[model samples]
Target: ILIGNLFTGNESMGNGGAIVVKSNSKPKIINNTIVNNHSLYGAGIWMSCSALNVVLQNNILWGNKASESGNQLYLRSTGSTYSIINNLLEGGVDSILFETPYSGILQDNYMFSPEFADYATGDLHLTCSSLAINAGSVPVVNMPLYDMDSNLRLNGSEYDLGAFEADAAATIVSQPQNMIVMNGDIATFTVVANGANVYQWEVSTDMASNWAAIVDDTIYSGATTSLLTVNSYAPMNGSLYRCIISGNCPQVTTISLPALLLVSNPDGFDENPIAVSVYPIPAYDFVNIIHAAGSRVIISDINGRIVADYAALSSDNEQISVSNLNNGVYFMKITSSNSTQIIRMIKD
Candidate 1:
């Protein structure tokens, strides 16, 4: 009996290059691939002397060469009981089997080349579109639990014909990259992953420490696909974005690395540019803001943390106290009725 055996690249001067059955010996060959053998009679299998009750199920007997009849099988036995079910053959049972008054069951046998992953390199794994996938019948006895590669035997509807099961794992080809865009402009992020169908993009405000799923809105689009678009805003600075991918293989999910979003405030963004000025480069007591009146001012440290905020500058050249702040570089964002401007500030 042969179960899950690979027979290839063998030669013989006589009969049976790979296997031989004689003297009424009944053999059960299940889930074996017999190919690429050369012999004078049967290159794959030679049976004689009334071998009865032979069972050949879920096997592949193809690509064999012989000098005489039966390139795949030479059966010289007569009145032998045999069952050849769900076996993929090279010639569809008429080109190989040479028996007088054949008495056996030949059901669900296919005549086509089983598309191997690589035939020259001896990689017998089935490809994605192989005809042997899900083509075997249900085994009533002596069914192996796993294939030759240790993959589950029945990954799909039924058993596969050959040795190895197909691998269907998803592979992440590309990841999203960081983007820098001006405020009020649009930014795009894209990812590429093979064998993946589901994509969910998320955003994090605190450098990926926390995440929230992004949806279709005024600021974001294509959040559920490989590409994600965002409308750049001042508040979105230092935000992080990533994508969660899944749905190619069973119970397999993955997430991409976080990408930073840096939003810059461009000059003359508004139609009417406003004159802005700030005094005291390294201020000790107070910094004067000489800009349009009734403007909002925001001060942040180098780490993008808001340190101080002031609104509704009632007078031109308003004085902002900087005595309580630490001695370091800071950023000041001033917004007026017409335009906005960002300036660098220093405290000593």
Candidate 2:
């Protein structure tokens, strides 16, 4: 599926500067922006002598120039069939050249100029007043869930034509923040995004080397909602958490920054626990640990396996060599006389 893409800034001395589909190539071109190409013939696309089915839907073909022939599309095939639907063709019907006995379905297509945000700067995002809005047919198959800018498609009552979906308030307004929760307490992280978005909570022990989706289990609930709640436990200490926000459009996935979860045992801890910090989050060869001078540090993996142990000689910041370790999430447990704290660390 050729979906949710932009094809531009191309020039050819001959035909089909942007695309040329020859015989036996049954490609489905959907939700694409093809613009500003120059060629002798078929500046945008050319299909010649194909014996298979060619599908083109929800595409934007604009600002293409041809020297002497077809400006947008040139179809010259005797045995091929096509389905061209719900596309915004800026060029008129004369821009397309079809052979005799044109066997294709052409319905709900538009020929008006699609008012792009900035055609000169190649920013083809649709404005609110664009005619391409709500001018498309619903797809039967290969439907994209998101639009070009990771915005949810079908945000309106119907699908919009062209590559981008016009939305004024469809964006991630706020992201989840980091939190510190006591063991056995409830930890909640919330995100404030707009539009018809889908949310999935994920946890990674190793900075973000690998992420596992959070399901609606006993310990974790509200995994699919904007707010995610987790019943904190000792095992959940130092685990990194984040949310994945996406829409129905293809390739419209966004992962938020990792939030550190520090699970403290409040019952046995002193009034003031030792302050600690670790960096650089995604460490390559080594990671620096800043903590109390007499603290003892232990590094362990998510499986509770101890990887390294160190004793701080002085309060001076200590650096641990992690070049031999594989890239993944690990926890650094710093223990002092009064309290213990686990900090999440990642090896890159």
Candidate 3:
């Protein structure tokens, strides 16, 4: 029974690189570095006979034992009980696992990342995309809620898969300026960006930098190259409006004047039965097909799923029932024999 550390000088045994205890010894093995020791039996430190109750705290067990058995540390019916806590145990293939009918408690210990760092640094900071975030099977005696480096774990559902969690944060941006408009009473609006992009808008009353004022915003779903009458309840009041673009575009945002002057719509609309609001596209039940001044209609889904054949009826409105139909995702191919336009619709 002792209260101090004992530095063994038996490098000849080639097991206790730093300090190894073979016989039964009741010692407070605190804050020591056990390394670079190799052994034919227990490369790091081989223990047999005698009860070795150790208070292994802040100690390191690595690169020592390289025996045929456990390269790091080994215990073979040591007839000893060990309390290994807050220590670093790095093994080769078997890492840190013992099965000798000998049982002990292992906890608050870290065994991932660098798995091989300067023992003095104690910097177990793991990089993002680390596979060792939460991959341990054994539980510690008194598991430290935090890792060796004192970082919080499992902010979400469950714990990570290893020692480190790639503690990284993402950035979210809002309200980018990229619209063109004029000082008008009311007009059509079109939003455009360099690449195929999307946008949403917020209403503001002032044009000055002092934007203490705030207004509600509207979110647009899917993607549309052009939009008409882009007006919000809030008055433009000569205030510069903006269209924030997102998705697969440049990160740096851009702003433009309120879109009240110029206007634009989709190209090749004549292909569609103009004035004919094709309803329930990708329809199942009944689809209401509207037509222009003098027009007829034919429809088909992308996969050629269903084709509705109709005559050139001289009517402004027509109803095509498509009840007993399958359920899935499909696009609309509407045509008037003269011009054709493909409009995408979803099936319920």
Among these predicted structures, which one has the highest lDDT? 1
TM-score per candidate: 0.50, 0.48, 0.30
lDDT of 2 by residue, 102-124 (tens): 88787767789888889889888
lDDT of 3 by residue, 275-336 (tens): 44778665667766566324444444433434555556456676656664456443333445
Worst ten-residue run, lDDT, model 2?
Answer: 246-255
> Considering summed lDDT, which 10 consecutive residues are worst modelled in model 1?
246-255
Write model 1 residue lDDT over 1-348, tens digit each, in one string.
778889999999999988988887878888888888999988988887576678888888878888877898888765577787998888888756666656778788898889988888877777777888778887647667777777666666567786665554345789898787877999999989877778889997753447899999999999999999999987887677888786433334567766667677544356446668898988788988886589998887655678888878989879889999999866677878766666667899
Clashes of each: 0, 6, 26
Full-model lDDT for every candidate: 0.78, 0.77, 0.43
The CA root-mean-square deviation of candidate 2, after full C-alpha superposition on the true structure, stands at 11.7
The segments of candidate 2 whose C-alpha lies over 4 angstroms from its true place after superposition are 169-348
Residue 259 of candidate 2: its Cα lDDT?
A: 69
Model 2 score (lDDT): 0.77
Question: Candidates sorted by TM-score, descending order?
Answer: 1, 2, 3
